[model samples]
Target: MKRYIKSTIGLCLLSLLFISHKSVNDNTVIKLNSDEFNVLMGHQGSLEGSIKYGPNKGNGFSEKDNDIVYGFTDVNDKITWTVEVPETADYLVAIQYTGKEFQGQTPDCTVEIISNGKVLSTALRGLTQYNESRKVAGTRQWFDEVIPLKKGINTITFHFSEISSKQIKAAKEELDNGIPPKSSASIAVKDIALVRPKVWNAMKVRAKELKPDLSWMRDGKYGLFIHWSLFTYPLYGDKQAFETFEWGVNTFDVDVFADLVAETGASWVTFTTCHGMQMFPAPIKTLEKVLPGRTTERDLIADLAEALNKRDIKLLLYYNMSPRGELAAKLGIEENPDKWFQYLNDFAREVSLRYGKSIAGWGYIDSSFSAYVMNMPWEKYYRSLKAGNPDAVVAISSHWWAQYSPFNDLQTSDSGGSLNNPLDKKLFEEGGRYEGLQEHSSFVLDGSWFPKEPFNGIIRRDSNSKGGPTFSEQEYLDYFHKMAKANVPVTVNMLITQDVTRDQPFVNPKSLEFMKKVKIALGK
Candidate 1:
């Protein structure tokens, strides 16, 4: 038979169990252990089920020694906790839980916070788990939000939903057939806490105060972003390129590329060191050990950095944070939080130590505004970069998590196209730093970032016998002027060929003329 447990810890008992307390003012704070909630088996049909309760502590939470809650596979599973409020006011509600994805898939669970049957917040999907372990629980990972509570007994219900109906049906069938249900999604909750807004606001303020100044990035209004890889030879686009393992980086000419970048009047040039395919152009000891031959024989990044620095143009290194293909296979372990984080730390440290101060900035992708990446020890990774170059400007994709985290120097305002009308300034305000915005513009006629196929006849201006629409000179100049007036730096994503026959990647005379016109118009 399915067993359910209803447990409660009185206010007096909670006071004794309280391990720590943080106060911004006179407002009272309360932390309730997960096992203390009144758990009913199959309570409500829309939200019906019970969780297995035990003292299996993992991710850092205050009630590590005390029993916690887990074994939530049913979609209708609901956990309710009642808190007595002294006054009716808004309080920051923070839930500390551990979420993990299985079999190389994204985390599959939807959670909603409801108060007295009223929805407090929309369901949040794709919640990520930590890749690190903790010895003693002490509030290491939490999902925080502010909600109003009544002065009397208020019930807060956490509703769980599986990502797909197929998974839910399978679990239900197993339970009916007298077999234990197995779930891909596993979330373990430690506790829930309520704190005054003043305390939360004060914490945000302190985080903002620590943000570094990015004036150097702001001063240079335009940048050139080169996204070349071994996949360039196959002419595969971003998504399809990651499947094959090939290193065609030998055909790249750094000096000629650097000269072309200088001609574009771009103040900085960002190169992709490791992209989706998990191929690194430069040698790193950790990468060599984990996935041998995945790296190129020549250190293209170093040579390019030196070449661009000679022209007084800064270099920003692009690192894809997502684990993919052979790299993931070689690592052989992903679910273990401690082991995964150690791998990430080693990779970051090796890259930072090798580049030193030659690179002016670092841009991380795939974690844009993601809670999963936010939960990782990103502060340690950022520190790794700073240890090598104290003045390095660190930023991430704007579309990813924009909240104030100490890990990044700035947040990109990438709106996906040439137009810069929609600017995201909330990241700067939330993080307590201001580093303008990073916008992307494409130079291709069809606006594709990379070539789709080999010699597809779009690389050169005169080779357009297969005629397609191309951006006019005026259009390019207008974009530059608009971003310049708005004080937002634009990074033009240029497609370079590995054809070896071309003198330079930007061989299209028409596109080259337009770039020169932009330089003249911007008075660079």
Candidate 2:
């Protein structure tokens, strides 16, 4: 339900943008030539060219399908790709490529655009790479750039100059002296292209003209919170004993769910390590030994970390701070809150040690605990996580943790009724609805888990959780903008079910349409 709602909202925003610019399509024409492309505008034209690679064997550059051969900075040898483009769009030109390399120490290459035997533009292309400086990985990457293009027949040349033997000796010396190599191929360049879009192509110009502030999210605004656990192992109730809530490693479709969460464009995602109804394979010796069917079959947390990292999504570990957990009932520690807290703290320690790099923060599931104890060790635990990762954020759910503590980044507000704007004087007093309050928190917290229908009355204690407000695309856009304007950030939870799966009710065509509309309103 949340997924469908989010998709619908995204598509609606997209449709609105396309509809508004429907007539603009008539103002431009695109033509592809052998080695070049053209975008004709009403008053100006744009031209693009393909990038040619050098011979692999000569300069240690291989002819492999996707190898980016470097070590070239010499004269007499140049790798060139030529193109013929009409004049006029010289002020706007761009070069783009998809590459994957570990390091970026390769010497930069220069690009020359010649039109009618005169140099129209000359620019330098630099090497860019991903991963840590000392240690790098072989990952696929993509990047694009914009450059100025001149009219009439044009020739674009990529000159790869080979490095002299003396420089190579120096590079070797730098490495031998326990220093890092100064010259390293940052990435493998897969393909390169030049692009020039005609019509309201004011994006580059506008960006250059107006300096917009883009640092709002230095502190995160919205994030994706996933509530999954052993409960998913058996569809809520599918066990022989059925004595305690069902839990097993087979409950979740981890990969599918990860992709689903990524599609929502969430900057951060939080997953429930364990819930009230299930016992996860937490690293507590006693707990792991006592828990039934707690197999070491699969590592869900590791899979989640990899998935989120692939999409550059921040990972937030959601853990229950209290509760013997469902398994604790069988272990005879179900009512012993003291040992339960100790076990939870140990579990948190293991998580911080194992997956600390992948985790951006810790979202403590506010369970039942004494006020003083909740504030005491839990606060220290949060501090310990910060010691592991200085940039990590922390959130707590219990009463003391929520109320009288600076150990939390977001205050978990479990308001029972509908979302309402407290700043609205008249509407707020009259109990009438106001804007911006319709969106609920998507953060991981106690009772924030999406409840299965036939949701016991205790689960949906808050009236808002039951038959909550349904929003249209416009509503989402409006709410998003209003929050931005008011300097308030919120995580909107758009519930989704397996039946819907983003294409529900005769294929949820409305979701995309709504997303399109929202994008326009947000001006994103």
Candidate 3:
């Protein structure tokens, strides 16, 4: 099935028809990565694009294979790829992209498939902050939609619109007035994947992750963990909890953090959503109602998930309860534990729904004592978190019930990597208590997950004085690989510092370098 017609309904004012006069007949997968994309810049706006791969090439992933098509500023910009299916069926059309061009706004884009001169499917999607960036579309957005196709060469084009002539005029006026232009809509096309029903690991719920499965984590081996919250803020003589968290929330760059993590070759990340304080980086209505001003409007968690998922790394959030809470006491939270938890559970549901399978795992409430003492419904809470995507692997504090808890999928335990709980089998063994549970052990390399008293978010100290790791490089790798091969997951927590002035967070540079070495030793 072939058609001989050069036409354009217009993705921009002049659709960039990247025509490849070759019919893709293989059933494996048709991928239009950075190398092969032929961009024909239409005569419209300032649309400059080329193949960008590795080192600041813009598609956040650090790997060379994660190349992207940069410079699609015009709404009419369309890139087309030809695919030949086995027969008339549906294919998964996933695009890998970045939305920084939109500057945190939704890029309502168009995607249409033409088969034999007729439109098969055309969808106008109000995509979540996404840039069609991966085989699974990264953020579980509609960019990973299913398109019906006829058995033969089918033309698929991904397009973005906005930045009309009026907006361009406005931007010109702003520039004339010595003001920065704010109305520029652009997107980087990483790659377009046309996959068959074989299903991408992070796709399909995944029959949406429909049932509990830990295979992905077990195989993932080890994860890079970082904790940044109210406690990390430099206090006493520096920025306090709320103040530091707010700054980190606003200034933290997901692209930088994701790139660093990708450079480490770690397959997963366990990011801190809350530690001693519930300074979450997402907008949760329930958290606001429970503790006003506690939640952020930025949706940092979602942004992180999108970025990490783009690099094929899984995300597991650490939602903790403060060991000692004077402020919480004053707020009367202890007086109504059940009601308080109800709000927290709702927030978890919201996070799960927004990120979906992109967030493959979760590290729920830290202390077992608090979970039980507060009468927190573990089963109910578990269900609420999984409601958005049921297949998510959830961990509970290593309680005796964690072994048999119907709602819990993994028994989680944590330590300072130097406490009574050492980083060994005992870390996950729980004194022989976890007889029948998937073991999880997370510990800090800095001896402290968050920066200690005087040397907090606002201050920096010598690495030696910071109470760093007790384990040697070989010791860490030996234990990490041993249990990882046994399907027992490990998360190595590294402390982070907040650059309040710069609105940036710095994970330990030495530790990150070690991770790169670890990735090599592990044969990643």
**Number of the top TM-score candidate:** 1
Q: Model 1 misses residue 442 by how many Å? A: 7.7
| Candidate 1 structure quality by residue, lDDT tens digits, 188-283 | 444444456674555445445545566655566778766664445332223323344333456566778888888878888877666755668767
Q: CA lDDT of each candidate?
A: 0.50, 0.37, 0.52
Error of 3 at 159 (Å): 74
Tens digits of per-residue lDDT for model 2 on 136-215?
22211112233444453333333222333433343334234422221233221222334445421432333223221213
Candidate 2 Cα misplacement greater than 4 A, ranges: 1-220, 229-255, 281-286, 290-296, 324-338, 368-375, 384-388, 398-402, 415-417, 420-449, 454-469, 494-524
TM-score computed on alpha carbons, candidate 3: 0.53
In angstroms, give how far residue 486 of model 3 lies from its true place: 2.6
Rank list by lDDT: 3, 1, 2
Error of model 1, residue 184, in angstroms: 24
